[model samples]
Target: MKKTQWFDFQNFFYKPSLTSSIKPRPFTAYSFVPFSPLAMLDPTILTIGGIVLGIAIIERILERWGVIDLVDQFSKIMRFILPVTFYGALFYFFATFML
Candidate 1:
């Protein structure tokens, strides 16, 4: 009895097929409409206006409910003081190290 190779596997793997279903399509790179920067303005205004409006609404509700009065004045004073102290420290560090 004798054994024989049925096919060349290398040629079968590398060769392109005649009945290939994949084909690249032509693409257009032009458009009829022009672009504008004004398109971005509405969304920017909407987001900023929404944040400001939300803050205003919350402040108004707090004022109406007298919640602001319930908070001690010292805590309100420290809110501004703490950030100022942090900014001063940051400025001092940057001035000493960066300059």
Candidate 2:
């Protein structure tokens, strides 16, 4: 039966107080815009790639010097290794702690 403040539209239409306009915003601060880094290396991927690349380089040198060709069969094996290692570790951690 009463027009309470919850649905009162008249009170909502308020003018800004003169004191608020004169008050300084002490906590006003500038925001920072982040920039992209030059090189973003994934530790696991890059380490694996580096090891593979090193083996490739060594094979190249050995072939040039006539020693051994190195175990060159598993060059692209990281596709399997990376996923298995990451997911296996994740599953292991989840199973160990969560379940």
Candidate 3:
């Protein structure tokens, strides 16, 4: 017996080339508005600094209210973790916004 040829295959295939005759709309010319680097710098710095300052203030408030003492058993571990987490978050926010 002879094997059937693969070229005999058929299916519901759509051809994109059928729309090749249509042309796309031309782009319009517009004025170029230059970005002010100083404007971008000020807000980004303020946001990152505000976040860090807010974290520090909250931590101090919690410590003053004896909250830290309540967790005395893990005080040392928390002291280490707090700054690292705050700074990491600050840096991440700054880097993301800058990009």
- Among the numbered candidates, top lDDT falls to 3
For model 3 the TM-score comes to 0.32
Task: Give candidate 3's error at residue 2 in angstroms.
Answer: 99
Compared with the true structure, what per-residue lDDT tens digits does model 2 show for residues 49-94?
6765676676577667765434344335545565776676556544
Single out the weakest 10-residue window by summed lDDT for candidate 3.
7-16
CA lDDT for candidate 2? 0.55
RMSD of each: 14.1, 15.3, 13.6
Better of 1 and 2 by TM-score: 2
Query: Which residue runs of candidate 1 sit more than 4 Å off their true CA positions?
Result: 1-5, 22-43, 64-99
Runs with alpha carbons beyond 4 Å of true place in candidate 2:
1-40, 68-99
lDDT digits (tens) for residues 1-99 of candidate 1? 699767689987988888869788998898554544454355544555565556556656767778876334534655775566556655654454421
lDDT of 3 by residue, 17-79 (tens): 445676898999875745435644566557666865676676677778888774464556557
